[model samples]
Target: MNTNSTIRARRIADDIDALAGITEPDRPYTRRAFTPKFLEGRKWLEQAMRDAGAVTQIDAAGNLIGTIRGAHPDLGTIMLGSHSDTVPDGGRFDGIAGVIAALEVVRALRDQGTVLDHTLEVADFLAEEVSIFGVSCIGSRGMSGSRPPEWLQRVAGELTLEQAIADVGGHPLHSAERDDIKAFLELHIEQGPVLQNEKIDIGVVTAIAGITRIEIIVEGRADHAGTTPMGARKDALTTAAWIALGVEELAKALASGEAHFAATVGEFEMTPNAANVVPARVRMLIDARAERREDMERFVDELDNGVGAIAAKTGVAVSAPRMVSDNLPTPGDADLLDVLDGACQTAGASHRRMASGAGHDTAWMARITKAAMIFVPCVDGRSHAPDELATAEDIALGAAVLLDAVMALDTKLQEDI
Candidate 1:
């Protein structure tokens, strides 16, 4: 790495270490949204942005935006950022790395005494992780005017979503209608093993997978284990287990040749906890995703049919309701992808084009403006866990690519204007 890159890498490592220290004391790194630890972490980040000499503010949706003025403020701004919230007992890097990288880009620009024609804005969005309210991307969705109205009514812990927004100095009803934002770019960890396994330095995301979540319930009669004979008992847990296995089998069968398809029963629960009684009900949460719309549809169809068959064979009443259906795959803007590719080349970082299996704030930002993402490899492709990690060198390389890409976009947008 070059001397500048080495310096930036050290800075990035230091910032991550500092932020990691602001987590829940008992949980180590748990900084869920709207929690005390999460709030403390945001405060630290806001101070860091102000110390970097940028104009900072929290938006109506609780997104913390720090703007650095450019030579020609009339031109639209180039925005970059990610979220700071983490999942329960989550790792240190996932969304936090992106926010720090965006700030690093602004700091680097200041250090070099560089100013572009378009203003630069770095943001740390609120609640990008799945909240207790069963919603994700609340801040980004609010910014793009895509948030569901019911989200405001849902209560998480002691506060409703709306109240949480207000507590953070945000107006939940307000949306940012700024046409001055020309584009958005985010730098994040790959969260998968592909980049590390391939030994690639950078990953230019082409598209984000469409996610579908279904809630499956199997109802059966609760009967005394001794009284109910093995042939007479209707076991809901056994039936739900069959359906879960069926989901895996169907996904594997459909993904035989496709690389971007996945289905998992990540959440499962059973009622009537008694050793002498049969389970009365079983609830399973099914999460499925794919790169293509047709594949997703087919997978859902197969799962539905498989569940029906299992219900018939097990003699249990089964119902699979579509709880969350976000099936539109957001493709990265072509022009922005080209810019990112060029940035990778200029930074001398080995890169490959890949599709993101996980969703990001960029997907919602793409609705408002051109949006793209840069991914750096994490150790063993692990994320959302305590062991999640990325090398300082790799993180710095991704941020360098982001810096180059932002500069390229600034020039390109100016010429277009």
Candidate 2:
């Protein structure tokens, strides 16, 4: 289970640094999908893939794929990748780290003069982050045949998503599901405190949490702030504040339990700009994720009852939480999870099994083929921000683990076939 001799930490650092440098000069580390800066990054990545001896092409789904043919092509493909797009001024390591690690795995295999039984493909998925078009996971969805036809008509500026795909070298009208992939792997920053706090080198993800967004609105009468008594005014803002605090308390209690759960009042708005006037309306959007559907059901039920009590105590009207969007949890492939765990042991990497609180392209790919991913700790467990950090050595270790996993999968998949 020795680490591959060809896996180079310096090379991983260089690739990360190079991608980090492609961001906007005014906004550091911002190579957002469907932008000029993003195209520049793609150009560099494509050239890098070619230099590493890959046959590179953009798929019909707008996914940039670099393939290395294997000794036995009939066994199908073992694909590795993640999205390359970033959130606004988001950290360089979020999605970029995974794509680079996959590319490095391909390079390491080539350097060792080893060809496996399954063809290898490295993908830089398009628009995994919410794009200018207000949609996400475009490439992954398209590749998996889950993208609705209406999505192609989704508009940004004067161009439809269909045109955007064409601009990126994809034929959206012809995008189809890939059945040739025998397995899929990805590596991403942990974006949480568990791994770093536990001092673990790798996290074998058990599943991706289901995401739910709930909306609530509180309504009350506006009155003169100075003239109205403190107790007499029916303030919507205060009622909403109470509900938010209640959410925190409930979420804390749930998180302390066995399964992973988190809820955040990520978006909020208050009406009535006058300082002297009482607030009339307040809307809150809660982002909640749960590993178990039952947990999410419990949360919603408790929230509904809590809001009812608050409405009775106060003179304001609080609407029941309404579902904005809900995505079911996706469990990682059990066999692939075993493969990744074995790879960790083989690479001598310390690791533990965990669930991903954030979504990834792996979830979509899971629908088409056996798929799983690993997480490397990021400093402070922070992501979607400019200050996110992960050490070169840590990422390099993850790359080595991925290389081992790919090698293992090369044979393990053939047995299944």
Candidate 3:
């Protein structure tokens, strides 16, 4: 790596560390979406962007856009961004890591005092945690125009999309367009154990997983436990447990390393909380994910079949409806991947190309523009927890790679024009 780049990387890291230390610290920087602390963090980030010598502005959707205007007006903007909001009790590193890294990248570019071909922008997206709305990536969804009109009417209580936008200080008409940029790059920590367990410093994410969520309800006759014989009585909880375990088995059967097929039965509830009463109803949520659309569909099918078989054997009624199937698996940009890989190699950071197991904001941006994500290792593969963390050096290395990738894209756009 060149001395200029190394110096720039270190400077950006220093800036990130400083910003992370000062942000809305209500109980150690636990800022949930739309809360007062989250808003404070947003304000601090806005000021930080302005102080970094960038033109800072907020979009209708509460996305803080920090812009370094380019000399070539014909070239479209190139953006580097991530969400600043956190899940409840989430680790400080999850979303803020990306936002701070993006901020530092733009700041570092300004400190380098170089004019770019395409405008450089850093965005701190809002409401990414889904803690407030129960749906993740709210900011990016609005910006990408992927939020269906039906969703606006059906979900999020009685508040329409227009009302929600207005409440959050955004305009609906402007929220649905994507006229700004040619491409995007996001830096984040690998929230899983893949990179850390593999002892890899960086991950070039090839695809973000597509999620399919289902709410399953198993209904059976409520009866007295003492009077109802095991052979005669229908137990909803027992049947639900069978289906849940069956779902895991099916996932194993469908597992092809190519798609990384996985299913999780993360939630379960039993009705009539009493030791003497049989559970009349059991409600469970099954989350299915895969790298490819076909695989995700197969997962859904398997889940349906599993529930069906269990219901038939146990004499329990089963009903499952998909709640969310936002199945857009973001395929990373080929050129962007090349740039990221090159950056990793140049920085002497070992990287493995892998698909992200979890969804991220980049998945939504992929619909409108060329987009990709770079991931650094998280300690013990932990994320979305208060203890989740990555070493400072690892964070710096990831930021350095992001800086190089952004610079490469900036120069490429100039050459194209």
Candidate 4:
């Protein structure tokens, strides 16, 4: 596996088949964020990061950078990307195979001429899926300034995440305060099924769960389904289906065996226009996660006391669980997970570590710096959708361990600064 790693794994499978043919071939690989086929797949990945010579841009929260420099460009930068949007019939390699394996690790360091000393960028971020404004790493939370003025007054297609960060050229009140990037790698696609059920070929990660979400709402009293009899009916969709089966039996009794602790309700809604009316109102969302933070505060306090005892035995009137987003657990950076487990044993591959249960932009670029990730192994682990596969030899062995963990985090982050 080295004719320049089979020509960068056939140029990352021909740049993921030309960014999955810039989507919208009448749906099914939709490419959501800012739409128009996600701005023509971010203009074909910003012209494949300017034909791999780098030096591109789009910041101010639209995030599409590129750079390349290195050679002590004032020692700092060393990012890497992930996010080409999708999730609505999504998955052409979840975040487009971590933005084409970080532009094939800057086209394999400009075809091995090497360079390094730091300064390497590569991003692609914007709307890391799950957004119609219900935010999801919207451009790594606006380049880690952590954008949240009500997430620029939420919108999505009709724009207004500050007009989709100034229609992509970005500058929604400038925010690239880069304290010399330092470290940030990414290389996704382990959407789950733990390295193809442990056949393993790389997945270092090690923590990124934290999400919360919530919403709830129940109400009731639409009535008249055959003159509301059933013992004086009130049923807000049967008390939101008994609070979605008590949020899957309180996340399987608080993951008694810790199956990566989770809780979901996915999303449900029911109002007047139903096969029968008696289903006054119901709207759930829930979606908790854990990897600790006191097991996401005891699964949102046992799902807010089991939705107040299923809205007081189904009389209905819930509403009170509304923490729409939390985001805690980010971890991953014990020296970038030992420089990605020594870049998967120096690319001989076969790795393990794990954690990520979805949610990325390297968990909001690990809130500013030294982030990490590098999965690779999707197939039956599936992803947002369109049968989300992965295997141009496990995404070129996770982009050759993300080009040896970005040249060992650009020489171990300049010897720990």
Give the candidate number with the greatest lDDT: 2
- Cα TM-score per model: 0.94, 0.98, 0.91, 0.36
Error of 1 at 244 (Å): 0.9
Tens digits of per-residue lDDT, candidate 3, 1-417, equal 345563344555565555455445455546776566667777788888888878987676657788888888568888888887776666478877788777777766776787887888888876777754566676787788876555444345555555555555666556545777788999888988888888899999999987777899888889999998889888998998898888888888767556666788888888886899998998888788778888877777777777787788888899965565557577898888998999898777899898887888898889899899999999888888767777767877787788888778877766655
Q: How many clashes does the backbone of model 3 have?
A: 1
Off by over 4 Å in 3: 1-3, 6-26, 150-164, 320-326, 414-417
Tens digits of lDDT, candidate 1, 216-324: 9899989998888899988999999999899889888867764478889988998896898899998889888777778888887888888888989989899965666
What is candidate 3's local distance difference test score?
0.77
Give the lDDT of residue 380 in candidate 3. Answer: 88
lDDT by residue (56-117, candidate 4, tens digit) is 87878778888989888888788888888888876688878878887887888778788898
Give stretches of model 1 more than 4 Å off.
1-7, 320-323
> How does candidate 3 fare on TM-score?
0.91
lDDT of 2 by residue, 149-193 (tens): 998998888989999988989999995689999999999999999
Per-model lDDT = 0.87, 0.91, 0.77, 0.80
For model 2, where is the 10-residue window of minimal lDDT? 1-10
lDDT of 3 at 414: 63
